[model samples]
Target chain A: MSMIKTDKLIYEYAKLDDEGNVIGTNRAIDAVDLEVEPGQFVAILGHNGSGKSTLAKQLNAILTPTEGTVWVAGRNTKEPENIWDVRQSAGMVFQNPDNQIIGTVVEEDVGFGPENLGVPTDEIWTRVEESLKKVGMIEYRHHSPNKLSGGQKQRVAIAGVIAMRPQCIVLDEPTAMLDPNGRKEVLRTVEELRKKEKVTVILITHYMEEVVGADRVIVMDKGSIVMEGSPKRIFSRVEELKKYRLDVPQATLLAYELQKKGVKLPDGILSTEELVEALCQLN
Target chain B: MSIKLENINYVYSEGTAYRKQALKDVSIEIPHGQFVGIIGHTGSGKSTLIQHLNGLIKATDGVYYFNGENVYADGYNMKSLRNQVGLVFQYPEHQLFEIDVLSDVCFGPKNQGLSKEECEKRAREALEAVGFPGKFYSQSPFDLSGGQKRRVAIAGVLAMRPKVLVLDEPTAGLDPAGRDEILDQIAKLHKESGMTVILVSHSMEDIAKYVDRIIVMNQGSKLFDGTPKEVFSHYKELENVGLAAPQVTYIMHALKERGFRVDTSVTTIDEAVEEIAKVL
Candidate 1:
C-alpha cells in the first residue's frame, strides 16, 4: 500500500468581499492525483501560489478536500475517525523553524509530539533521545533552543516530528528561511531520516538545487500537477519548467545554454561535477 | 556621499551570563551608488550589522558617518538619517498591513509629514519603480501573492525616497523566477537611479551576478571584501566559513583541475560559458 495517495483532490476556499461575505470560490488545489510509496523520497517544486502547499496540507488533513479524497497510510483523511491516525502517520515540518519550535530546551521540544500522543514518560524520553541522535542533535539535548543556529533549530524541529514515529514526513519549504549551510544541514538530515528510519519523504521547495537528489520530482503550477518524472527526466525539459515559473539546477541550466550554443553536451546535467565531466569529454 | 563604520562592536546582553559579541571591530565604507552584497552564515551578525546602518541598533563601540555627518554626534537627527537609509527586513511581506497596496506604500512618506497628495504621488512612483501593476493599487495587500506582497513592502520603503537601500534576504521564500525578477528590478533601479544598494543574501549565485563588491562576514567580523571575481577566488576559505562561491565557480575550478584552461575566478554563468567556449 502507498504511504500517501491523493485521488483527484480538489480544495477550494471562499473568496470574500470587502464586507466579509463569500463572493465566490478560488480553487487552490484542482483535481490532482498523487501517490507516494513507503520510504520513497519525493520532491514537489512550484512557484508561489502554485498549490504545492495546499496539496501538502491535504496529506496531513490540515484541510479536508472540498472534493475527491486523500489517503495516508491506507486511511482516508476526510474521515473524522481516522484524523488522528492520519496525522500520526504523516508528520509535517513547516518553513520557519522558529514558529514550529516551542520548548525552551532542545530535548523537551523533541518530546512534545510524543507526549501529546499520550506516550508514557519513559517512552517519550527514549524517543526523544533516539530522534535527536538520528538528526545529529543529541549533543544539544539540554541546550536552549534560543541559542541554537537556524540549522540546529530546524533539525530539532525534524526531531520533534520523528519522535512521533510517523510513517511519512511532509516538509513545506523547510529550507526557505535558512542560510546555505543551514539548508544543506536540513537536507542531509532529511536524507538520513529516509535512509535510517525508512520514512517516506515529501519535500516541497522552491530551490532547484535542493531537489536534484530527490528520487522523484513533481512540478505544480496554478493548482495542478503540470509535470512529474525522475529528477533527471524532469530537468531535461528546462524550457517547460521555466514556462511554469520554475528553474532547473544551475549546472543543468549551464549545460542547456552550452548545448544551445552548439556544444554537444548531454541533456539534464544536474551537478557541477557532471557538467565538468561532460565539458571535458567534448574534445 | 558615503556611509562609514569604523571599529564597530556590538555585544548582545552585555554583562550578562549570555553575553556574546555579535560584531567585533568591524569597519566598512560604502560609497554612494555602489552595489554591495553581504554574505554570511546564520548568526554571523549579518542582521545585527545592517540594523546599525539605519540607527535601529546603536553599536557598542564605533564611529558611524553618513555623508560626512557623524551619525553618533550629540543631537544627531536619527529619524532623518533613517529616512535617508531605508532598511528592508527579511520576509518584508510580514510588514505589510494596509487595507490596500497603494496606501500601504504611502504610509512611509506620510509618516515623514508629507501631505496626503504628495504621499500618494510618492507611493505611486515607488510602486511603479518596483514594477507593481497599477491595476492592483487598490487591492488588499493580504490578497496579493508572496512575491507581489514582497514588492509592495519594498515599495513602501522606496516611497521614503531613501538614498541608500539595505535589503535583508528579500528573496528568502520566493521561487526561481520570482527571485530573478526582484533582483533584476533592483539591478535596474541601481543602474537608472544610482541609489546605493546593500543586499544581504545567502545565495552566492545572486551576489555574484548583481553586486559589484562582496563582503564576507564570519564570527562577527569582516572576513573578505572585494569584487565578485576576487572574493569568489577564495571559494575554499568561504566554504570553511559555511559559505561558498556560485555553482559556476565550482564548475570552472573543476574544469581547470581536469586540465582544461578555464578561468576559475569566473563566478557568473555567462562568464563561465564564454570562458569554457574559448577553452573548448
Candidate 2:
C-alpha cells in the first residue's frame, strides 16, 4: 500500500465578511489525486498561491479536505479520532525556523513533539539523541535554538519532526529563508535523514535546483497537478515549465540556450557535471 | 548625496562576557544613483550593515556621513536622514498591517506627518509603480496573494519617496516569476529615478543580472567591492567565504579547463551561450 494516498482531494474554505459571515468559498486544492510509496522522495514545485502548501497541510491533517479524503499510513485524516494517528504518522516542518522552534534549547525542542505524543520520558530522550544524530546536529544539542544559525536551526526542526518517529515528513519550503550555504546544509541533512530513517519526504519548494535530484517531480498550478514525472522528464520541457512561471536549474537553462543556437546537446541537463560531460562529447 | 562609512564597527552586548562583534572595521562608499548588490553568508554582517545605512542602528565606533553631514553628530536630524534612506527588511510582507493596500502603502508617509491628501496621492503613485492593481487598493492586504502582499509592503516604502532605497532580500521566498517581476520593477525605478539602490541577496545570478556593482561581506568585514565582473572573477575567494559566483561562470571555467576557449568571465546565461557558441 502507498504511504500517502489522496483521492480526488478538493479543499475549499469560506471567505469571511467583516462580521464573520461567510461571503464565498475559495478552492485552494482542486481534484488532486496523489500517491507516494514508502521511502520515496517527492518534490513539489509551484509558484506562490498554487495550493502546493495546502496539499501538504492535508497530509498531516493540519487541514482536512473540504471534499474527498486523505489517508496517511492507511488511516483517513478526515476521521476525528484518527487526527492524532495521522499527524504522528506524518510530521510537518514549515518555512520559517523562528516561528516553528519553540523550545529554549535544541534538544528540548526535539523532545516537544514526542513528549506531546505521550512517549515515555526515557524513550523520548533516546529518540531525541537519535534524531539529533541523524541530522548531524548532536554537537549543538545543548545550544539555544536562537543562537544557532538558520541552517542549524532548520536541521533541529527536522530532528524535532523525525523524533516523533513519523513514517512521512512534509517540508514546506524549509530552506526558502536561508542563504546558499544554509540551503545546502539543510538539503544535505534531509537527504541523510531519508537514507538513515527511510522516511518518505514531500518537499514543496520554489528552488528548481533542489528538485533535480528527487525521485519524482510534481508540478502544481492553480490548485491542480499540471505535470508529474521524473526530474529528467519534467525539466526537459523547458517551454512548458516557463509557461507555468517556473524555472529550471542554471545548467539546464544554459544547455537549452546552447541547443537553440544549433549546437547539438542533450535535454534536461540538471547539473554542472552532466552539462560538462555532454559538452566534452562534441568536437 | 552619497553615503560614506569609515571603519564602522558594531558590537552586540558590549561590556559583557558574551559580547559579539557583528561588524568589524567595515568601510564602503555608495555614490548617488548607483545600483549595488550586497551578498554574503548569513551572519556575515550584511543585514547589520544595511541597518546602519538608514540610521536605524548607531555604530559603536567609526564615522558615517550622509550628504557630507555626520549622521551621529550632535543636533543631527535623524528623522530627516531616515526619510531620505528607506529600508525594506526581509520578508517585508510581515510588516504590512493596514486594513487595505492603499492605506498600508500610505502608512510611512502618513507617519512622516504628510497631509492626508499628499499621503494618498503618494500611495496611489507607489502602488502604480509596483504594478499593484487599482482595484486591490480597497482590498485587505491579508486577502491578497503572497506576491501581491510583498508588492504592497514594498509600496509602503516607496511612498516615503526616499532618495536611497535599500531592499534586504526583496525576493527571498518569491517564486521565479514573482522574483523576476519585483527585480524588474526595482531596476526600472532605479533607472527612471536615478536613486541609489542597494539590494542584499544570496542569489549570485540576481546580482549578476541587475546590479552594476557588488559588495561581498565575510566574517563581519568588507571582503570585496567592485563591478560584478571584477568581484565574480575571484571565484575562489568567494567560495572561501561560503559564497559562489554565478553558475554560468563555473560552467565556462570548466569548459575552458577542458581546452575550450570560452570566456570564463561570462556570468549570465545569454552571455555564456554566446561565448560558447563562438568556440563551438
List, residue by residue over B1-280, the lDDT tens digit for candidate 1. 5999999999999999989999999999999999999999999999999999999999999999999899999999999999999999999999899899999999999999999999999999999999999999999999999999999999999999999999999999999999999999999999999999999999999999999999999999999999999999998899899998899988888888899988789988899789988988
Question: How many residue pairs clash per model?
Answer: 0, 0
Best by DockQ: 1
Can you write out model 1's per-residue Cα lDDT over A1-283, one digit (the tens) per residue? 9998889999998998978999999999999999999999999999999999989999999999999999999999999999889999999999999999999999999999999999999999999999999999999999999989898899999999999999999999999888888989999999998998899999999899989989999999889999999999999999899999999888998999889889999888899989988887887
**Chain B TM-score, all predictions listed:** 0.99, 0.98
Off by over 4 Å in 1: none
Cα error, candidate 1, residue A91 (Å): 0.7
Which candidate ranks first by TM-score, i.e. highest? 1
CAPRI grade of model 1:
high
The residue-by-residue lDDT of candidate 2 on B2-94, one tens digit each, is 999999999999999879999999989988999999999989999999999999999999999999999999999999999999999998999
Q: Which candidate number has the best lDDT?
A: 1
- Model 1 chain B weakest lDDT span, ten residues long: B271-280
Give per-residue lDDT, candidate 2, residue B29: 90
